[model samples]
Target: MSDTALGKDRRFPFGLTIATLIAFAILIGLGAWQIKRLAWKQDLLARIEVLKTAPAQPLATALANAQGRDLTWTRVSVDCAPAQPATLPLVYGIRDGDIVWRATALCRATVGGYGAVLLDLGVVKALTGQSAPAPVALAAPARAVGVLMAPRQLGGDREATVQKFAAERPAPYILMVETATPVPPGVTPAPLPAEISNRHLEYALTWFGLAVTLLFIYAAMLWRKMRS
Candidate 1:
């Protein structure tokens, strides 16, 4: 047998070493990616903190100022008249550890910047396999004081209902109602979450720790091979 083959077979695990190197590279890459994610998440949380507490602006002014910028979590006020109650959509969600449907509707904004805006009126609770609650009637021409948020993806049926209002060219953001004059019946205004978890740093540390552990394991295997 050749010297190289004999050496690989008796003294070194060439194939195993190559596999370990590949796995180590993958683990390190994952760790680095997580670090980048950690930075991004931190920045987002910081921005949200500042925007949520600043004085509320008019919806039109907020939209204009937010041009080419993120407007999520910006408190805004608008005079909106809810569309027909029967056509409103119910988006599925969880609130207070119970299943609930978020009541959503397209409202005609009096401001000129946007023809219409989407509103999250509140939540309606119902159990699984139960029929949805009756649609609540929102008082007309409400002064909606709320924070603007980016819309989340919806299920097919609910998405279809929202699309029905697309012709109105509603603002891209949804106003999560904090308060409105003459509130809609049987609905609770669900605003921005009280706390947004920032666990990216912890996740990044875990990924890095795993990478170091892999290196130690690889080194131990080589040590055993050399000793033998």
Candidate 2:
């Protein structure tokens, strides 16, 4: 054999091939994981849609029975006006800071007195100054539509959320307001950010494409060496 033949054929880089294969494996694994996540997310979305359309029951009823029970597929209603800005803080957020938000507090329906109240039924863009003072007469009664979420009752847990309004009720998270419309005293509606993050699907497809390319390249390299 010639001196050059005995020498390593740099073109057939075994170490480089091994490293590329490892990288390919990791990317392929990540792509597979993303696919699994997509399945899980779809199921969750379906569950939420079902909950949205379920029959609307009384908040008090749902609370009494649904509390500590399986509440995945239940719904309810609450009636109460947003507490005054002083008492029930109409909390709102600005680009810089947040102040009391406009509210359509839900009070449990009755002849008189307050009933399960969830405030802030109106929407307002914060102003430049210190949490611009809300309209003194912003009495928009919001007939908000939402899911009968488990009330967020305060407890001893350190990480638990504490409400600024009346003392903690059964479940601290009273309800997850799903829909809202403007009434006379409209409370500030909660901002609902989008749930779809499509980039993962794109990345997963990319990794799969790269893995396919690697397979072809490996085969082509082997064929060329055999031909030589």
What C-alpha RMSD separates each model from the true structure? 3.5, 7.3
* 1-228: candidate 1 lDDT, tens digit per residue: 787866765676778889878887887787788789878878877876796678888999988877588787788888866455544666766555666777776678855466888778777543322356554544433677888777653333544554677788778777888887667766678776646677766777787788788888988988877765
For model 1, the local distance difference test gives 0.71
Per-residue C-alpha lDDT of model 2 across residues 108-202, encoded as one tens digit per residue: 34311323444334444452244555444443233545553323321122112224334523233434455544443333344232353446677
lDDT of 1 at 116: 85
Model 1 earns a TM-score of: 0.81
CA error at residue 69 for candidate 1, angstroms:
1.1
lDDT against the true structure, per candidate, is 0.71, 0.50
- Residue 152 displacement (Å), model 1: 4.1
Instruction: Quote each prediction's TM-score.
Output: 0.81, 0.54
**Best-fitting candidate, measured by lDDT?**
1
At residue 172, give the lDDT of candidate 2: 34
Which pairs in model 1 have colliding backbones?
A: none
